[model samples]
Target chain A: MKAITLNSFGGPDAFELRDVPRPAPGAGQVLVRVHATSINPLDYQVRRGDYRDHVPLPAITGHDVSGVVEEVGAGVTAFVPGDEVWYTPRIFDGPGSYAEYHVADESIVGKKPASLSHLEAASLTLVGGTAWEALAVRAQLRAGESILIHGGAGGVGHVAIQVAKAIGARVFTTARSEQFEFVRGLGADVVIDYRNEDHVEVVMRETAGEGVDVIFDTIGGDTLSRAPDVLAQLGRVVTIVDTAQPQNLVQAWGKNASYHFVFTRQNRGKLDELGALVERGQLRPHVGATYSLADIPLAHARLESRDSGLRGKIAIAVVPPAHADARQPRA
Target chain B: MKAITLNSFGGPDAFELRDVPRPAPGAGQVLVRVHATSINPLDYQVRRGDYRDHVPLPAITGHDVSGVVEEVGAGVTAFVPGDEVWYTPRIFDGPGSYAEYHVADESIVGKKPASLSHLEAASLTLVGGTAWEALAVRAQLRAGESILIHGGAGGVGHVAIQVAKAIGARVFTTARSEQFEFVRGLGADVVIDYRNEDHVEVVMRETAGEGVDVIFDTIGGDTLSRAPDVLAQLGRVVTIVDTAQPQNLVQAWGKNASYHFVFTRQNRGKLDELGALVERGQLRPHVGATYSLADIPLAHARLESRDSGLRGKIAIAVVPPAHADARQPRA
Candidate 1:
């Protein structure tokens, strides 16, 4: 099987396309014939020596993948050969999906939505999972509430805007001037220009000084530090970014606000729910750009540059099913 | 009318007993003859001008009080003259429960329990509300789960231990060696000695490293910093003491632990429910010491020197309901 292998963690060029043996399904696991895989910031860290202790040398780094089950492990009843499934491969343990075939645990694999293409489904899983964990699992965002989703034009933020809107919440997102229209077109009630305007002042004025009900701090830094200034009493803030600098959040104390550090957990059932929402036309992943499997290096470089208004996902088209293989199989 | 007023902002002695006119109840308010009153930390802070911006000065400082209704404001229908009720009086706008008479909105007062004395009932309003808010609102401690309460013998801790147990959750509490028996007697499943032992080590050993489902942290600093260590995956940690030093709390993110800051809101319905719990055999406030109303200065000194293992609340017994007209009502 052709795989993107890192001999020594360094940079984009470190991803060496080498022929490796296909991964086998262990007990309670499944072998997925890779259809597509998506790039996340975690991949960049893993490709560098930054996560040396985390991902062992000679590791395959992709986390999100949508594919067809080629084989089932012992004692597994949930899936079998030819079953179309999607999953965010757990960091370190599972051999990732940046290859011809990958291994996934049954607990973290969801049936791919009928409405979504393999690339779209693959693109949505990881970032969508992150947004779901923060907004739904941690914050418990309810209807009639408001949220300020920083980086709303990014992968997780774009999906989160839709999810918040799906639940009848008012969403305010921060983006560059160029992407403001793009974010607003996706259901953001308010989109602030991060460069020219002060987000706290703009958000406070927009919320009539009461501030937001929740803050999905997808972008952390000085942005996260001042986030609490725009929080309502009893409001919640969820942050996923780990930064060296500390945020001054004392303002939240007077309001009795809560801070939730959300790192998405792998749950197959949740993925299936996400699949259903995608099928319902209520949720969609913006696959900002797609690259061929051979162009993995360029895809990663573009993602790491952070210069583009990449308003959704950066996905790689792996093993596209043939016309015959595309025929309906057991879902 | 004579009232204990804050003539200046400083220590306990700043309170001066002087003549003042009784305040009339506004719309939907009630003026009551305060039979017994209790002191809270907020009372001291307000008198010392710590809350000058939030709470106007030259005002009385007490909050919790049990008293008889003397007059009802226009449009009030819940009670008439002579009704027994208890409440944690609202801030500056509400002339506090420290005097012979105090006024509170009907929305913030509840009928007193028939089973307890005015002093015990007075104790119920603050600590009880705190315990309820920490356990029920912040932590959401469910049956069969485990909860660990730090500083289990303090004003709020003692009551929280019992409340967690009453909700069918296993309760663990930390206290000084001298207070172990006191905490154990309150139905704590496990009592940790902060003086001689490591609470985290003890808690980890008892739970086999799975940790508690919830942590009610009344003592911050080291205790709060260590609280998430004993939290199970997806567990909750609520703190009353504010942490002067910031913590990354990165360790707890792996377990998906959530930290909540509990600043209890004044809700009369919760107070009424707590009153019911007190009337039953489920909850009891430990009244460790008692003082005469005139000895309030001495009482504050004693309260300042509260040691570990002190049983119950430090209460200054005011005009006992038995001597209704013995002293002229302050207002």
Candidate 2:
């Protein structure tokens, strides 16, 4: 099978397209013919040797997958051959979905949304689960509340705006002026031009100086450290990034706010919930770019450059299908 | 009226015993003839100018108080003259409890426990509220769960041990060997001599390596930053100290734990709840040392030294009575 293998961690060029032996399903697992996978920030970090000590060498590092069940191992009763599935591979586990074939536990795979294409399903797996875990499970965002979602045009942020809106929350998001309309079109009630405006000031003013009931921080640094200033009393701040840095919580203490730091886990339950939302049209995947299996390096370069003007995820087509959906993205 | 005032922030010697105009109750207020007040870590921090910018200069900076209502202002129906009461003064509000008389809003004072003396009530007010808020309101510790409480012999930890036990939780506390029996007597199921034993090792070993469901951190620093190592998968770490330093949350993120930083607010409701516990003998005050009103500087020095062998809060007798309770703590 054709796969992108990292012999050494460095830059995008380190990903080499080569022939690799296909993986086999073990007990309670299913063999998947990976159709599409997507690029996440973790991929770049793993490829750059940021997690070199933790990740074994010569690794296939993609995490998000939309694939078809090719075979099933003994004791696996949940999935059978030819079933379409979507999931995020457990991080730092064995082989990843950057290959033509991969194996994953049956427990972590969910039936793909019937209404969406493989590329779309692959694009939403990791980021969609992260956003859902942050808002729904961790923060327990309730109806008729207000929320401030930073980085509204990014992968998780884009999905978060829709999720918060679906739960009947008034959504306020931050984005550059050029992306303001894009986020607003996705059901964001207010879009702050973060680069040109004071988000805290604007959010406070919009909420009558009481601050929002919840803050979803996809972007870290000062935005996360100072989140309490714009949070209502007893509100919550949820993040999936930058927990490595030391953050002061004196302000959070004064407001009695809770801070939830999530490193999203691979679980079939969250994927199933997100699939229901996708099927209901409350959430729709956004694929800003696509690449063939051999062009994995190019996909990484586009993500790292930050000039691709991508609004959501970058997809990689691992296998060509006989009848690709008309909505399938191409680069 | 005599008061201990800080004209400028500095060492304990900076406090001046001076005569000040007696405070009078305003609408919906009560004039409390303060019988006793307790020294908290915040009192020493304020005296050392750590919060100089936030606190008013020439401040009377005590917080916990037990007193008798001398008069009630217009619209104040909660208390009458000679009624015993206990409360925590709001932080950074005008004039604290380190004086002969203090005026407080009726909404923030509660009826004192009938069975406890004024000194005992004063000793428990601030610390009791802190412990209750951390465990009950923030962590929501459930019955049959396990908890680890740091600084078991200190102000907050002493009360936290009793509270967790009262909630039917198995409580583990950390203290020096000399204080192990003391914490155990307060209903701690396990006491680790932190000076010699690694609390994490002992706690994790005792819990069969699953770790405790909640950790109450009264003594901060590394104890807070590394708390995730000894926390259950979805456990909570509640702290009331050390919010100034940057702490890593990488482990917390991986464990999916929640961090709650509590800056306890002054409210009559919490005080009333705690008072009921005191009356039921479920909670008791432990005053390790006592100082006369004129010895405010000495009390600050004792707390700062941290070698005073004090097992609980250091208390101040603001207006010494003719016949003080025989159990009144002495330096």
Candidate 3:
């Protein structure tokens, strides 16, 4: 089985394609013949040695997976061989889904949405789960509330806009003017040109100075630190990115706001919920770009470049499933 | 009317007794003859100019009030003259309750507990509201869950321990060795001598290394930043103290923990809930010391000293009520 293995952490070029032995399913686990995997910020972080102490050298680390079950281990009754599935590979665990075959606890794998191709499924898994957990679970965003999502054109932000809108919330997002149409198409009610406009001023004005009930900060830095400024009393701020700079929480204290630092967890239940949304035509994957199994390094490089044109998640085709035969190279 | 005012931001001696004009109640408000007022950390901060920009100089800065309504303004029907009430005065909105006569919106005052003296009610109001909002509203601690309260013998922490226990949660608290018995008497399931023990290790060992479901951090500083160490996955941390130091949230992200910065909101409903708790004998005020209205400067000095001998909140008797005649001078 061919896999992207990391002998040492450095840059994108450090990912080496090597023939590795296929992983086998253990008790209550399923062996997945991975058809596709996707690039997330976490992947780049792991590849850059951010989690070096937790992740040993000579490790395969890609988190998103869309695959067909190749085998089921003892006590795994929910899924069997040939069943299509999608999931976020367990974090800081043994091996990830960068390989041709990967094994995961059956409880953490969900049936792939029948409406989506493997590439789309892989592209949506991690980002969808992140948005769901941040808004629905952590923030507990409610209907008729207002939400501001930073980085509206990025992987997690785009999905967050859709999720917040699906819950009957008024969605506000920040994006470059060039991506305004793209983000607005994904259900954002208002789009602030982050590069040219002041997000805090716009959010406060649009909310009539009361501020939004929730802020999903996909873009860190000053965005997260100033979230409370555009947050209603008792509002929540959810962020996935980590930075060294300290945020002034004096404002948060005045509003009695809740801050949730989320690193998405892997679970079949969340994936199933996302699949339902996809099947219901309420959520759709935006695969910005796709790469062959051998081109994972190139995908990482492009993702790391912060190119303005890459508007959504990057995907990596591991097995080139039949559904992707006519799929375009870019979203 | 007589009042203690801050003409400057400095030591406890900065407070000066002044003959100030009594304020009349406005619409939907009540004029109260304040009988008792309690010292909170916020009062000290205001005196020290920590919030100089928010609180103007020459301001009356007491936040907790227990008094008899002297008059009700037009359109105010909640309480008339002679009604006993308690409240946490609106923060950063106007002059507080450190004077003999104070005015507050009727919506933010609640009936004083029938069973407690004015001194006791005053001591409990601010601390009770802080504890209630942290555990009940922010943490949403449920029955059978576990919680840890730091500074267990302090004003908010002592009340928090009782509140968590009243909610049927397993309560753990950290305090000095001298205050261990004191906090235990308040229903703390386990009391760690923070000075002699590593709280994280003790808490982890006691919970079988899974950690508590909620941590009510009354003692700020590293306690808040390191709360994730003793927090279970999906746990909540509630804090009232504000700091500029950066916290390493990498661990919190992995645990999916929620951090709430609570500056207790002033509302009559929360005070009513707490009054019920006091009347039911589930929560009690731990007033460590009391001073005459003219001795407010001394009260501030003692509170600022952080003396281990001061076991609970400091109280200032503004205009002693008839019911407070038999009350002790200290806990």
**What TM-score against the true fold does each predicted structure earn?**
0.94, 0.89, 0.93
Candidate 3 or 2, higher DockQ: 2
Best by TM-score: 1
Q: Across residues B1-331, which tens digit of lDDT does each residue of candidate 1 receive?
A: 6678777888888877878898889999999888888766666657768668766667777878888999999999999999989888875565777788888889999998876677777777888988898788877889999998888887788889889988999988888878878889989989888788888899899999999999988777777767667888888888876655666566666667777877657788888779778777898777776665666666666656665545657765678545642422211
- After superposing candidate 2, which stretches have Cα over 4 Å from the reference? A18-24, A80-82, A198-201, A204-213, A228-235, A243-257, A319-331, B16-22, B77-83, B144-146, B197-213, B228-235, B248-257, B318-331
lDDT of 3 by residue, B100-186 (tens): 999999988999987777888899888898889899988999999999998889988888888888899999999999998899999
The 10-residue segment with the lowest total lDDT in model 2 chain B: B322-331
**lDDT of each prediction vs. the true structure?**
0.80, 0.88, 0.88
Clashing pairs in 2: none
List A-chain TM-scores for all predictions.
0.95, 0.97, 0.97
Q: Give the TM-score of candidate 3.
A: 0.93
Per-residue lDDT of model 1, residues A1-331, tens digit only:
9998888888899988989888788999889888889888878877877668777778777888888899999999999898888889886775777898888778888888877778788888889888888888889999999999999988888899999998889999999999988789789999999899988998899888999999998788776678668889999988887644644445656668888877657787679768777877889888888786788999889999995567688888887435313532111
- Superposition-based RMSD of candidate 3 using all C-alpha atoms, in angstroms: 2.5
* Residue B227 in model 3: lDDT: 88
Residues A265-293, candidate 2, lDDT per residue (tens digit)? 87999999999898788999788888888
How many collisions per candidate?
6, 0, 0
Clashes of 2: 0
